[model samples]
Target: MDEIRAKKENKEYDWYVLFVKVGYENKVISQLQSYFNKKMILPFLPKLEIFHKYSNGYIEMEYKILFPGYVFVESNLNEMKFISMIKEFIHYYDAPLKLLKYGDSYEFAMREHEKSMLQSFCNIDFCIEASTGLIKGNKTIVLKGPLKGRESIIKKIDRSRRKAVINIDIMGKCVPITVGLDIPIKLP
Candidate 1:
């Protein structure tokens, strides 16, 4: 348990992203957790809590994957072995486990800064909890949570849905991610 956490914090380990079926992010993480040693692989799927309204007219909170079809893992294992493990999973599930590649090399891993930004957004449990903030005029001020001090990245806010859309760099591409934002108050 702590061994994995320690290794993740180590600089030698690299972060890699795997593209799987959209709905299988959690399943793939679970399978990887069982197949690999905890210290060798730290699989994570960033999730966020959102409010859902049921047919009974009641609202409940639920967790949703922040980036569908992608799972990030920090590992110090050999690239060949990691590819083989992904191949094994592809064979077993009959679903593709495609590792994101850069340039012509399949071993290309995410840069340290990219990984650091992600780590800052997600907590130890790999979840981005709702950010509490206030809206005044045309500005959004995040008082707490992962989005604090990161208001510049916010492109739009939907108060009804309690979601904020922001763009972040992933695999050298700008990807828009929706995160939970609670604006409990508004000021003139």
Candidate 2:
């Protein structure tokens, strides 16, 4: 019981942001998991479930990366240890990895508030489903899911492509996240 209490009291991990090759986010995650103990590190790539339309009355569900080239990781290890682990992993793959940086000196770490916000938005599965929204009088109204109450974060909505481009601040830098939306179905 005391051990459990101690563990709860000492939450040592912070969410760190990593920038990888645009299409290599999943590959990097797989490599990290294979190299490190899965319990010691948690990597996340926010994905969206999109419905692709096809001719002859066919629709297919597909998963798309929400933020291309960016991945978030949570770990209890200290910064030096984490960096060392990443360096070792890169050495094995012969691919370069970079942590988000501020100017030239410091690594940009995600703020607690930002982390919590992302957690709430992504939930435990780390995947956001396509939301259904309607455009009325030049305003977009989300009808369901996490995007409903957080409409303000959306910078632009692409109706034809059914994608919402949201602006989020990470470590004082504004980054854009693109999420898919289901085409609005007309109510009968």
Candidate 3:
């Protein structure tokens, strides 16, 4: 079974957000994977597909980070020693780490709604797929992708750019996330 699936079946870990240096997301993820077991620490960096237009009507597809400089980590916070070890390791690499806080506790975690939303974007292989939507008489309809049926959370939609922006509250701050989508289907 895959690591995420196994972790879901066990239900022993809680999701936490780690703030790292910009452009170092991949490096930190690699280091974390090497130092910890899949169950002990699972790092997730959600990505989306974007298209770059060329001069000759040729468009190139590329993957971009959905949330830059932040990585979601799943682990059991009860394991204080393990948490400390991770902190030390991150510090050793000269990467500053900030654990999200809720109220006065350091154990602030992702809400069920947020977790479900994120999980919907990820396939069984743990890859995040780009979402799709349609335009129907001034209304946006998500067709067959992760963003489907979750329109309530969408804050804005840039039809020209084919992107949807959603605001999520994380660690007491509202973070705006921009997700790329394919050209919308216009309904008659």
Candidate 4:
């Protein structure tokens, strides 16, 4: 059985970020997963864009790199020699070490975190939606918080008491919340 400890030392699967060509994250992930099943995670991402159908008869659209230049890899800390093969398969710009921790669970958590961060980077950094009393009709900027600078469009509201609801879609999950305003809300 796997042990869950309060703390651990050393880890397998270090966090890394690779700058790569757009639309290739999955390709790299696929190649890697084919070699290391259940041992990897390639979170799906959607780049929602407002397309313009020009009167001049051309349709143009913008694409957001939901997960830009990154694909998270999970591996044994003591075994990272073949990680470079991932770089080659993905045609990556480069691979860089992201963080170091003292235990296995922590390290695993960090690896998952890097993956989630990569997948959510653009959306969380650009948009927010608030649907709450008092804060109604107000597009509150994320002045400061865990999601600092990450803005979204208001989808629902309940602002009678200095609160707002923000929405975020992560790894294909929708997370809507009642949050703060002009205050440093403590994060968990």
Which ten-residue region of model 4 has the weakest summed lDDT? 127-136
- What TM-score would you give candidate 4 relative to the actual structure? 0.33
**Cα deviation of 99, candidate 3, in Å:** 2.8
Candidate 4: C-alpha lDDT? 0.41
Candidate 3 local Cα displacement, residue 61, angstroms:
3.0
Please write out the lDDT profile of model 2 over residues 35-91, one tens digit for every residue: 877766777787777667677657677787877888877777777788777667656
* 49: Cα error in model 3, Å: 2.4
Error of 1 at 5 (Å): 1.0
Per-residue lDDT of 1-188 in model 4, one digit per residue for the tens? 02211112444434444444566766655555565434343223333332334677564544444345545444443324434444355454343322223244333233455345534533432322221122223444455443445555445433323344556543334556444333223233
Predictions in order: lDDT: 0.81, 0.72, 0.71, 0.41
- Give model 4 RMSD, 1 decimal: 12.5
After superposing candidate 1 on the true structure, give the runs of residues whose Cα lies further than 4 Å from its correct spot: 8-11, 53-59, 78-81, 84-93, 103-107
Model 1, residue pairs in steric clash: none
Alpha-carbon lDDT of model 1 = 0.81
Model 3: CA > 4 A from native = 76-82, 125-128
> Local error of candidate 2 at 40, Å?
1.4
For model 3, how big is the CA root-mean-square deviation?
2.7
Give me the candidate number with maximum lDDT.
Answer: 1
